[model samples]
Target chain A: MTPILIALTIGIPWLGAIIVWLMGDRREDLTHWVSILFSIGAAITSVLLLPNASQETALTIPIGGDFGDFTFVADGLGIFLSVIAAVIGSLAVIFSKSYMKGEGSLGRYYAFVLFFIGAMVGLVLSSNLLLIFLFWEITALCSYALISFHNDDPKAVKGGIKALIITSIGGVGLMVGALIVYAYTGSYDINNFLANYSTIPGNILALLAFGFLIAAAAKSAQFPFQTWLPDAMEAPSPISALIHAATMVNAGVYLLARFYPAFKDVPYWSEAVMIVGALSALLAAVMALVSNDLKRVLAYSTVSQLGYMVYAIGTGSVYASQFHLFSHSIFKALLFLSAGAVIHSIGTRNMLEMGGVGKKHPLVKWVFIIGALALAGLPILNGFWSKELILESGLKNGPLWLYIVMVFVAGLTALYTIRCVWLVFFGEPRSDYHAHAIGWEMIAALLPLAGAALVSWLAAGRFSVLLGEKSLPFHAIEPLPYKEMMHEILSLPTLVVMAVITAAILLWVFRKKLEGLINGLKSIRWAAENSFGFEAINNAIVKVTQSTAEALRVTQTGILNWNVFGILASVILLLAILVLGA
Target chain B: MNLPIPLVVLITILCLAGIGLYCLLITRNLIKVVIALQLIVKGAVLAFILAGNMTGQLNLAQSMALTVIVADTIVAVVGLALAVQIRLKTGSLDIKSLSSLKR
Candidate 1:
C-alpha cells in the first residue's frame, strides 16, 4: 500500500503536468481547474502515505550494477516533506486560479509548477543517491523555468539564469559526492553509506561531508550563495510561495538533517554548519529590514527562517530543525500568499506605494497579520514554539557565541516582519494607486495556512514520533509528548528570546525618538542594501563563466566535416594509446 | 596475393570508412552526408563481426550489428526528411546555407 502510494505521490503530479500542458491555453479556465484537481490528488496521496511510514524501502527497482537498485523509502522525514510539498503545491495552484487569471501561457506555467511538485516529492522519497541527484536537478530546472516565467522581462530572465547557474553548482557538488561514494562502496544506496561510512578512509570521508555541505549551502541559499533567492522574487507570487518559500529552499536544510548522524562527528562540520546558518539568519534579517520591495523582504525572511532550521540541525537535533521547518513552511507560505494578494491587486510590488492597503482588503490584512505574528515568533504561534525549541537546543549543545547571534537574529526577525507588515498594510496611503478586490481563490489559500500557523505547534507530539528512531535509524530522535515539548520550550532562554523579540518590536514603535541611532546605523543599512558586496562577487563569477564559454565557442564550427574529423582524430588517438601500451 | 579472411575484411572496412570520410569532407548536400553516414555504419558493422570472429563471440556481434542497422536506418530516414524540409524552406541543398552560425 505504501509503495503504490509512493508511486502515486510522485506519478500523479507528473501525469498532471502532461495533462495540463496538453490541455492548452484554449480553455484557460479548464486548465486551471485540471491543475488544481491534479495537485490536490497528489497532496491527498502523500498525506495518506504518512501513517504507514516505516524504515523499510517502500519500493525498489533492481538496476543490478554499478549504480545499484533504485530505491524509495517512506521514512518519517521523506513522508512529511512530501506532504508539505504536495499540500502547499496544491494551494499555490488554486491561488493561481485568481493570481494568474488572464495571464498568457497559463498552460506553460501550470505544467512546470506540477512538474516541480513531483520532482520535490521524488527527491525526498528516493534513498538512492543518484536518483536523488536527478530529482534535485529536475526541481532546479523547474525553479529556473518558473522564476523566468515572464520570459520577455529581462530582469525575470536574468533572475532565472542566476538561479539556474548557482543551483547547478550545487548539483555538481552533490553529483561529485555521490560518485565518490559509489567509487568507494560500489553502490549509491544512501542507507548503506550512512550505516557504513566509517569504513571509508578519514580524508575521503571528510571530503564527502564538506562536499555535501557546499551543496546544501548553495541550494538553501546560505551565506555566500544566499543572493539568488532574493532575485528569485521575479517569479509570480504563487510560484514564490510554493517553490521559493515552502518547498525548494527547505531541500537544503532537509539534506543536512537527514545526514546529521553520519557527519556529526566529522571535524569542524557541525561548527561550519552552525556558522553558515548563523550568518545567513543575521544577514538576511538585516536585508529584510531594509528592502523596499515587498516580495524581496519576504524572500529575505524566508532565508532567515531557513537559517534557524539549519542551526538546529547543526546542534544535533533533527527533530527541532524539522519542527521549525514544518512551522516555517506554513507561516512563510501564508505571508508570501497574502503578500501576493496585495501585489496582485495593487499591480505593484513597491511597499512605499502600498500603505493603507488594510482599509480595502480587510481579510487580507488580518491574515497577513496572523502570518506576521508567526514570523515575529510571538507567543501562541507555531513559529514561537519551534524557534524556542531550537534556541534551547542550541544553548545546550552549540557554542555560546553562536547561540547569542541566533537570538539577536530572532529580534531582527521581529523588527523586519513588523517593518514589512507596517510598510505594506498600515499607515496612511503613500500613493493614490487604485486597489482591486481580493479574489476568493486567494482567500481560500490564505485562510488554511493562517489557521495552520496558529495551531500547528499542537502537533509536536505526533511529529516527533513520525521522525523518531524507527524510521531514521542513524538519527535516533526520541518522541516527546506535547506537554513535555511545551515544557521544554517554556524555559529561561525562551523568556530571554521573547524579551529580545518584544524589545525589537517596541523599538520599531518608538522609531521616531531614535533618529540619532538610526542615523548612526546608516552604514549597516547601506551594506544591507548592497547585499554586503556578495552581488558584486556573483556578477564577477558570471562574467568569468561567460567569457570562458565565449572563448570555447570558436571550436564549435557546427560543420559536419569538422565534427566527424574531430571524432576520427579522437578514435585514432585512442587506438594509438592502446597500441603503444601493448 | 592470398590474404587471410580477417585481413581482407579489415581492409574492406578501412576502404569503406575512408570513402565515407572523404565524401563527408567535400559534400555539402545533406542527402550525400546521410549516404556517407550509412557507409561508415556499414564499415562499423563489418568490424564488429571481424572482432567477434577473432574473439569467438560471433553471435553477440551479429545481434549488435542487427541492432545498429535498425538504428542507422532511422537516422538516415530522419536526416533525409530534415534535408527535404530544409530544401523546401531555404531552396538550397548546400549545408553551408543551413549554418546558423553566420548571418
Candidate 2:
C-alpha cells in the first residue's frame, strides 16, 4: 500500500505531464483539466499516505545488477513535505488556469509544472542517494524550463540560465557527498548510510557534512547564492510562487531537516548552519525593505523566510523549522498569488505604480492583507506561532546573542511586511497604472490559503511529534492562556513579541519624519541593498567557474570521432589494469 | 602458466589507450579530440569485457558498460550537433573562435 501510494505520489504528476504533452499545443481545456485533476490526486495521496508512514517505511525497486536500488520512502518527514509540494502545487495550477488563459503555450506550461511537481515529490520520497541526486537535478531542469517559459524575453532566459548554473553547483555538492557515502558504505541505500555513517572516519564525515551544507545553502539561496532568486522573478508570478514558496527553494531546507539527525552531532556543522541562516535572514530582510519591484521584494522575502527555517534547524528545533515550512508555504504562496493578481490587472510589478489598488480590488486587498499579517507574525496567524517556537527554541538551545539577533530580525520581517503592504495597497494611486479587480479563479486560489495562514498553528503539537522533539521537557514561557491541545498558541511572551514586531511596523510606517536619521546611517542601507557586498563576491565566483568551464570545453575538440575514440581508449586502459599484471 | 586470449586483449586495450592519449595531447583540431574520446571509450569497453571474463561476472560488467555506452553516445551526438550549430552560427570550427565566450 505504501509503495503504491509512493508511486502515486510521484507518478500522478508524471503521468499528467505525459497526458498534457500528448494533448499538444492545441487543446487548452483538456490540458488544464488533466493537470488540475492529477495534481489534486497527488495531493490527496500524500495526505492519505502520511498516517501510514513510520520513520522507516521505504520502497526499493531493483534497477539492475550491481547498480543497486531505486528507492522511495514514506517517512514522517518526507510525507510531510510531499503534502506541501502537492497541495501548493495544485493551487498554483488552478491559479494558472485563469492567469495563463490565452497565454502562449498552455500545453508546455502545464507540462513543465507537472514535471516539476513530480520531480519535487521524487526528491522528497527517494531513499536512495543516487536516486535523490537524480530527482534533485530533474527539479533544477524543470525550474530552468519554467522560468524560461516566456522564451522570447531575453531577461527571462538569462534568469533561467542563472538559476540553472547556480543550482547545478549545489548539485555537485550532493553528488560528491553521495559518492563518498557509497564509497564508504558500499551501498546507495540512504538508510544504510545513515545507520553506518558514524563508523566512517570523522574527517571524512565532516567533509560529507560540509558538502551537504554547501548543497543546502546554494539550493535554498543562503547568503552568496541568494541573488539568483530575486532575478528569478522574471519568471511568471505563479512559477515564482511555486518555486519560491512550495517546490524548488524548499528542497534546501528539506535536505537539512532530513539529514539533521545524523549531522546534528557533528561539531561545527550546526554552528555553520546557524550563522549562514542568521546572516541570510538579516541581509535579505533589509533588501526586501528597499526593493521597489513587488515580485523582487517578495522574492527577497522568500529567501529571508527560508533563512528562518534554516536557523531553526541550526538551533536544533527541527520541528519548529518544519512547522514554519508548512506555515510559510501557505502565506508566501498566498502573497505571491495575490501579487500576481495585482500584476495581472495593473500590468506592473512596480509598487510605485500600484498604490490604492486595495480600495479598488477588495478581494486582492483582503487576501494580501491576510498574507501580510501572517508574514508579520501578528496574533491568531500561523506564522506567529511557528516563528515564536523557533525563537523560543533558539533561546533555550542556541546562544542568547543569536536569539536576540533573530528576534530583531523578526521585527525587521514585520516592518518590511507592513511597508510592502502599505506601498502596494494603501495611500493614493501613485502612478499612471490603472488598478483593476480580480477574477473568480484568482479569488478561489487565494481565499483558502488566507484561511490556512490563519489557522495552521492548530497543528503545532503534531509537528513537534513528527520531528521527534515532543518528548523534550521545556517551559511554555508565554503569559497568555494557550490551549494545551489545539489552540496552543496564546501566551504573554508571544503577545509581547507581537507588540515589539508591531512597534517595528509602526516605526517603518512613519519613517518619513525619521528620514534624516536613516540617511545618517546610509552605509548600512547601502550594504543591505547590495547584500553587504556578498553579491559582488558571488558574481566573481560564478565568473571564475564559467571561465574554467570554458577552458575545459577546449578539450572537447569539435570532432565527434575523437570523442568516441577517447571514450574507447579510456575504457580499454582501465580494463588492462584490472585484468593484466602491472 | 596459461597465456589467455583475453590477457592479450587487455594489453591491446592499453596500447590503444596510450595511442589515444598521445593523439589527445598532440592534436589541435576539435575533430581529433572526438576521435581520441572514441578511443577512450573503446578501451573502457575492452577493459570491462576483460574484467567480466576474469571474474565471471558478465551481467554486471555488461550493465555498467551499457551506461558507459549511453554516455559516450550522448557526448558524440551532442558534440557533433553543437559543432555544426557553432560552425553555422560563427562560420568556423576553430577552438579559438569559440573564445567569443569571453564577451
Candidate 3:
C-alpha cells in the first residue's frame, strides 16, 4: 500500500504532464482540468501516506550498482513536504485556470507546472542522493521553462536563463557533495551516509557539510543567491505560488534539517547557517519594504520567511523550522494566489497603481488581508505560533544576539506586510486603474489556504509526535497544545508584536513624515533597490562568461579543415599525456 | 614473422596521421580539406588493425576496418554534396570564403 501510494504521488503528475502536453492549447480547458485532477490525485496520495510517516524506506528498488538502491521514505519530514507540494500545487493549478485564462500555450504552461509537482514530490521522498540530484535538476528545468513561459518577453527569457544558471551552480554543489560521499562510502544511499557519516575522516566530513550548506543556500535563495528569486517574479503568479513560495524554495531548509545530525558537529557549520539565514531575512525584508512591485515584494518576503526556517535549523530546532515551513507554505501560497488575482484583474504588478482595489474586489481584499495577517505573525494564526517557536528555540539554543536580530526582522516583516496591504488595498485611489471582478475560481483556490493559515497550528501536537518519535536526529519534545501554544506566544511580553503594531500604525499615521525620512535615506533605498550591488556582481560574472565564449569562438573558424585540425590536435595531446603518465 | 612489423606499422600510422593533420591545417580548398579528413580516418583504421593483429584478433580488426570504410564512404559522399552546395551558393571553394557561415 505504501509503495503504491508513493508511486501514485510521483507518477500521477508525471503522467498528467504528458497527457496535458498532448492535449495541446487548442483544448486549453481540457488541459487545465486534467492538470488540476492530477495534482489533486497526487495530493490525496500524499495525505494517505501520512499515517505511515513513521515507516522508513517504505519502498525500495535495488538498482544494484554504485548508484545504490532507489528508495523512498514515507518518513514525517518527507511526507510533510510532499503534501505541501501536491496540495499547494493543486490550488495553484486551479488558480491558474482563471489567472491564465485565454493565455497562449496553455498546454506548455500546465505541462511544466505538473512536471514540477512530480519532481518536487520525488525530490522530497527519495532517500538516494543520485535520485535526489536527478529530481533536483528536473525541478530546476521545470522552473526555467515555466518562468520563461512568456517566451516572447525578453525580460522573462533573461530571468529564466539567470535562474537556470544560478540554480545549476548550486546543483553542482549538491552533485559534488553526493559524489564525495559516494567516494567514501561506495553508496549513494542517504540512509547509509546518515548512519555512519562520522566514521568518515573529520576534514572530509567538514567539506561535505559545507558543500551541502552551499547547495541549500543556493537552492533556497539565501543571501547572495536571493536576487534570482525576486527576478523570478517574471513567472506567472500561480507558478510563483506553487514553486517559489510553497515547495521548491523550501527544499533548501529541508536539506539542512534532513541532514542536521551528520552536519551538526562540524565546527562553525551551524553558525554559518545562522549567519546566512539572518542576513537573508534582514536584507530581503528591507528590499520588500522598499519595493513597489507587489509580486516582487512577496517574493522578497518568501526569502525572508525561508531564512527563519534556515535559522531554526541552525539553532538546533528542526521541528521549529519544519513547523514554520508548514505555516509559511500555507499563508504565502494564499498571499501569492490572492496577489495573482489582483494582478490578473488590474493587469499590472505595481502597487502604486493599485490603491482602492479592495473597494472593487472585496473578496480578494479580505483574503489578501488574511494572508497578510498570518504573514505578519499576528496572534491565533499559524504563522504566529510557528514563528514564535522558531524565535523561542533560537533564544534557548542559539546565540542571543542572533535571536534579537530575528525579532527585529519580524517587526520589519509586519511593517512590510501592512505597507503592502495598505498601498494595494486601502489607500486613496492613486491611479485610475480599474480592477476586474474577483472570480469564483480564484476565491475557491484561496479558501482552503486561508483556513489552513487560521487553524493548521492545531496539528502542532501531532506533528511534534511525528518528528520526535519517528525521525532520528529530530527528537523535538512534544509540542504544547493549541491553547498552551497561544498562551506561551502571548505571554512573551509581546515585544515583537508590540513593535510590529506600533511601527505599522506610525507608518500609516505619519505617511508624509516617513516619506521625508524615506527620502532622506536615499542612499540606503538606492542600495536596497539594486539588491546592494549583488546584481552587478552576478551580471559581471555573466558578462565574463559571455566574453570568454566569444574569445573561444575564434577557434570555430567555420572552416571544416581547421575544426578537424583542432580536434585531432587535442586528441593527440591527450594521448601523449596518457602515454607519459603510464 | 620475426620482423619489426609492429614498429613499421606504428611509424606508418604516425606519418599518415601527421600528414593528414598538416593538410587539414594548411589546406585552402574545401575539397583538399575533405581529402585530408579521409586520410586521418585511414590512419585511424590502420592503427586499429595493427592493435587487433597484435592481440590475435585479426578477424575482428578486418570486420571493424570494413565498417569504418563503409562509414567513411558515406561521410565522404555527404561532405562532397555539402561542398557542392557551398560552391554553387558562393561561386568559390576557398575555405576562407566559407567563413560566412559563422555567426
* Candidate with the greatest TM-score versus the true structure: 3
The DockQ figures for the candidates are 0.44, 0.10, 0.60
TM-scores across all candidates? 0.93, 0.82, 0.94
The digit string of per-residue lDDT tens for model 1 on A455-486 reads 99899888998999556688788899977877
What is candidate 3's lDDT per residue for A380-419, written digit by digit as tens? Answer: 8889889988888888888889988898898889889989
Q: Give candidate 1 misplaced runs (Cα > 4 Å).
A: A63-66, A560-565, A575-582, B22-39, B63-100
How many angstroms is the interface RMSD of candidate 3? Answer: 1.7
Candidate 1: give the clashing pairs. none
What stretches of model 3 exceed 4 Å from their correct place?
A472-490, A493-503, A512-520, A551-555, A564-582, B57-67
- Tens digits of per-residue lDDT for model 3 on B2-92? 6598898998898888898899888888898788879889999999899899999999999999999999999999999999999999999
Going through the candidates in order, what is chain B's TM-score?
Answer: 0.96, 0.82, 0.90
lDDT of each: 0.92, 0.83, 0.89
The count of backbone overlaps in candidate 1 is: 0
Candidate 2 residue-wise lDDT, B1-103, digit = tens: 7788987898889888878877776675666667777887889988997898789999999998999999999998887788788778978776566655445
> What TM-scores result for chain A when each predicted structure is judged separately against the true chain A?
0.97, 0.91, 0.96
Candidate 1 docking classification: acceptable
Question: Residue by residue across B15-87, what tens digits does model 1's lDDT show?
Answer: 9999998889779889999999899999999999999999999999999999999999999999999999999
